[model samples]
Target: AQLFFISNGLSVGFASIQTLTDKSTGLKKGIKGDLTTLRPTIMTAVPLILDRIQNAIESTINKSRFARIFFAIFFSQKKFWSYYGLDTPLINLIFCRKFKAALGGRVKIIACGGAPLSPETHQFIRNCFDLKLLQGYGLTETSASATIMSLDDTSVGFVGQPLDGIQIKLIDWEEGNYKVTDKPNPRGEIVIGGHNVTNGYYKNETLTKESYKEENGVKWFLTGDIGEMFPNGSLKIIDRKKDIIKLSTGEYISLAKIEAELKKCPFIANVCVYGDSSKEYVIAFIIPNASHLKSLADKLSKSGLSFKELCNDSEITAGVLQSIRQIAKHSKLHKVEIPNKIKLCSEEWLPENNLVTSALKLRRKNIQDFYQKDIHLMYGNEHKP
Candidate 1:
C-alpha cells in the first residue's frame, strides 16, 4: 500500500505551531483541496474530521431534491440491505460511487483515532463511502496507536485488540466503582506496557511516578482511560478515569460518552456534557447543526428567526431535546446518564475560541465555564427536557 503524509508535523517533532497557516499559495492547495485532489488510498484522521466529511456528503445529497427522494425511497430496499451484508460490491458500484467520487474516488480505508466516533456516524460513513473505517486506540504516552483494527475486522463499538509486543491489563478503579471482578463486561483502568510506550513524562518526576508503576518486574503506564474488555478480547473505552464524576444521587456518569451520544442527534452539531458531584442530573451545552435547524424552522414556519432566537425558541428547543432523548434511548444510556437540562448556543466551537483541542475534542472545563450563565438559567427553571 502506498502512503502519503499530510500534517502540521506534530507527530514528527515540529513543535513550532506558529509557522502553520491555512493560506494556499502557488500550486499547492489547502487541506480541503489536498484531500479532494491528491486522491490518497488510505487516510488517517481523528473522528471529528470524519464527521465533517460525512456532513459535507449529507449536505450535498440534501441539495439535490431528486437525490434526496431517491435515497429515502431506496434506503429501505433489499438492495441497500445487501450493502450491509456480503453483497456490498453491487451497492458501491451503484449508489456509493457518487460518494466515493466526492473523496477523490480513491480512498479505500480511513483510520480513525484520537476520540470515539459515534456509531451512527461510523455506519453512515461506511455506507456512504463503501469503505472500511478502521478504528485505532492509543494516546501520546503509548507512542501513537497501541492497537489498530485489521482490514477484515468489521466490528463496531470497540477499538481493536492490543498490537503485537504490547501487553495490556485492566486494574479495578475503586473511585469509579469499576471492578474487573464484575460480571458480563468487566471494566477498569487500562494499563499498558510495551516497547512503544513512553518511559515517563519529560522532566516531571512527580507526574512520572504517579502515572507509571511497576507491577512485579514489568513497568506499566496507567492510561487514566477507563475501558471495558469484551468477551471477544476487544476493548471499548468508556471514559477517562479522572473525568468520571459521581452525581449527587451517587451515580457515576461518563461525560464523554454522553456527549458522543448527544452528538448523534441530527440537530446538534457539537455538545459538551457538564456535571459536578453536587448535581443530580447532567446539563448539556449544545451547538445546533445549522442546516438541520433550518430544516426544522422551515417546517415550523419560523425560518426568519435569528440564531439566538431560534436557539431559545421553545418549539425548537423541545424538538432538539426530544431528538437527543431518542438518541440516548437508542444508545441504551441510563436516565442518569442523559442530560436532563440542555442549553443551546449559537456560536460554533472553534480552536480560536479555545473550546476544542486541535484533534477537535471538547475542552470540557473551558466549555462549562464559558456557558456558566446559560447553565445557571436552565437550572433556575425546572429545565424540563
Candidate 2:
C-alpha cells in the first residue's frame, strides 16, 4: 500500500510504535498522534491492529461514567440511522468528533484486510467513526488486488465483488462438503483467474504445478480459501482448505474459523485451536488479554499476581476456558467444535518466535510443536491410532 501511494506521486508516512502508542498506558491509541505532524486522510490496517484499537477505545469508554453514558446514547442512534443509509452529522459532531480527533481528525477512509474482521468490531468502528470500514480480500499471490468493499456498500461480512478484469470462480471441495451448488449461496473453494494472478511461485515447480493452472489461455490460481457467494455477488471468505481437520468421529472442523470465533471472547487475545485426527475433541492454546485477565483475577481475589502467575492460576485458567466455551456455544459451534480444554500462555506469539506470520496469522504447525507438552497433557494419554 505504501509503495502504491508513493508510485502515484502521493506522500506516504509510516506510523511507528512511538507515534501510535499512549505513553501512559502503553496501549495503541489508533492513529492518535500529533496531528500537525501527519494528519492522514486515508489509512489501511490489518484486522489485528484495528481490533486492538477497538479494544483501547472501548476500555477508555468503560473507565468513565460520563463517557459511557454519552457513548451509549449516541452509538445506538448512529447505528439506527446507519441502517437506513443515513448519516447522523449531528451525532458525529457531538459525540464522535472527539473520537475521530484521536484518529488524526481527518481520516475519511479506513481499509482493513489480511484477516477477517469480526462483525462486532466491524460495526463498532463504523458506528464510532461514521465511515465505512472497507473490508477487502486478497493474498500476496494476487498482488493484493482481488476484491474490495465499495464506498457505498452498507452491508457487513462480505468482501465486495472482484475488481475490474479480475475473474473469480468457486470449485467444489468434496471432503469439506462445500459445493458450488449449495443452497441460497454457493460455497466452495475460490479460484482467481485474471491478469492479477501470478504465473507461479519462484523456483518451486512442484508447488507451482499444484497451485496454478491454465484454461482457455487465462492463468488461474487456486486460492486455498473457501468462500461463500452472496446473492448480490459479493464473496465472504469462510474457511481455509488447509485449516480443515477431520476428527476420529468423521466430523470436519475448520480450525481457522474456530480460532476466529474464539478470539471474539474479551479474555482471549489470541488463540490456536488444535485437533488431532485420531481424537474426538479440540483444545486451544491461548494468549490471554492481560488487562481483562487482570480484571478477572481481581474478581477471583487473585489480584497482585504477576501476569505469568495469573496464567498458571487454576482459577484464572478455568475462568478463561469457561469464557471460551461460552463464546464457542454462542457462536453456534458444534459440541465437538468447542475446545475441550485450554492452556494460557503468558508470552505472545510473534513473527520473531515463528509462531505466527508477519500478518499475525497463526502458524499452526509451529504453534502445535511449540506447545506439544501442554497439548499432550490436555489430551490425557489418548494413544494415537
Candidate 3:
C-alpha cells in the first residue's frame, strides 16, 4: 500500500536526512517523509519505514497494542496511554489497492536497503501480507547500489550475492588471526571493487587511501562491515567493525548483535542497543511494532497482564517487557546485553525531525546529541525498565 524507509544510526548514503532537506521547505525540523501517493507494490526502502507502517497499523486496529508499542518506543517515564490513538482507517485505505489480475496482488514485492532489514520484519511482511519482500545490501561508496536479493534466491540470512560486475572478497587487516578471518564461513571485512566504487573522496586523499584499500593490484573499497560468506555463496553481515563496544571486562560486544536479537521479537520496530562496560550496562531505544504489539497485548491481557496495571509510573503491558527478555534468551544473548531500562520513544525519527538520513541511514551522533539529557538521566537513575 505504502512504503517507508529509514536509517538514523549509520551513514549509508552520506549526509544525514537533516542536512540534505530541500531549502525551500524552510523548516529546521528536517525531512518530513517520503510517502508516495501511488499505490506501491515493489516498495524498497531502509528499515525505518517498516517501523512506521507497524505503528500506524497498530494505532488504528488495536489501542492497547498501540499503547504497548509506543511504550517500548518512547521508553519514557510511564508515557504510554498519553500517546495519540490508532489509525486503522489509514491502513485499510492503504492496503485496499486496486489491481488487475495481471498484477497478482495489491503489492507484489517489497525491497529494503540502506541498512539491514530485521528478519522479523521481513518474515512478517511476507507471511502476514503475503507479499514477496526482498532485502538489498550496498552503500553510496558503491554508487549507492550493489548486491540485491531477488525472488529466485531470497535466503533467510544472506544479503544475496553481488550484482553484475561487482567483485567481492574478504580480506584480513590483521595477519595474526588470518586463519580466523580466512575461514570460508567466518567473519571478515566486506571489500567491493567495481565500476561503481568511487575513486576517492573530494580533497580527502587520506580517507581515500583508508577507504580504497588495495593488495597485489586488486583495488577494493572497504565497507567497514564484518560479514561471513556463506557456504552457499550467500553473504551474511556479522557486525560493524566500527560499532563494537568494549566492556571493561575486555569482552567486545557488537551493537548489531543486540539489535539483531531484539528485531527477532515480533513486536519490536526500531532497536538501537548501546553502552560500554565502562559502566558495564546496556540500554536500548525501542520503537515497538504497534500492530503486532496490540495482538500480543490482547493475548497477554487474557493472562492477566494489563498495560495499565503493569506499572504505576507508565502503562505498558508486562508482555512488552517479558517479550524482550524472552528474545534475549532465545537469541542466546548476554543477560547484561538485554536492555533492562528502556524508554518508549514513539515519535518515528524522521528526516524532518532531524533524526534520519536521506539514503535511509541513522545519524547516531545526531540522535545521541538530541537525547543526551534523557539518556544521561536514564543511566544515572537506578531504575531499570
Which predicted model would earn the best TM-score?
A: 2
State residue 381's C-alpha deviation in candidate 1, in Å.
10
Better of 1 and 2 by TM-score: 2
Candidate 2, superposed: residue stretches over 4 Å from native? 16-19, 23-37, 64-66, 383-385
In Å, residue 21's CA in model 3 sits off its true spot by 23
Candidate 1: regions farther than 4 A off: 1-33, 55-87, 312-314, 381-385
lDDT of all predictions = 0.76, 0.85, 0.60
In order of appearance, the predictions have TM-scores of: 0.82, 0.93, 0.67
CA lDDT, candidate 2, residue 372: 85
Candidate 2 lDDT trough over 10 residues, lowest sum: 17-26
- The candidate maximizing lDDT is 2
Candidate 2 structure, TM-score to reference = 0.93
Order by lDDT, highest first: 2, 1, 3
Worst 10 residues of 1 by lDDT: 12-21
Ranking by TM-score: 2, 1, 3
Count of clashes, each model: 0, 0, 30
Candidate 1 yields a Cα-based lDDT of 0.76
Residue-level lDDT of model 2, residues 1-385, one tens digit each, is: 7877999998887764235534323345443454325777887777877677777787778879998998899999998899888978899899888777767777888898988888888888888877678999998888888899999888888888899999999999998889999998999999998989897899999999999999999989999999999888899999998999999999888998898888788887788899999899998988887789998999999998999999999899999888888888899999999998889998878788999887778898899888888877889887442
Per-residue CA lDDT of candidate 1, range 1-385, in tens?
1212434322221211221212212233534345454666766667766676666567767889998887666444523564445545665677788777766688788888989877767777777777778898988888875777777666676788888988888999988888899788888899998777788999999999999987676778899998899887789887797668888898888888787777767677778888866668888888887788888899899999988899989899888888899989998999999888787788768777999887778888788778877877767654332
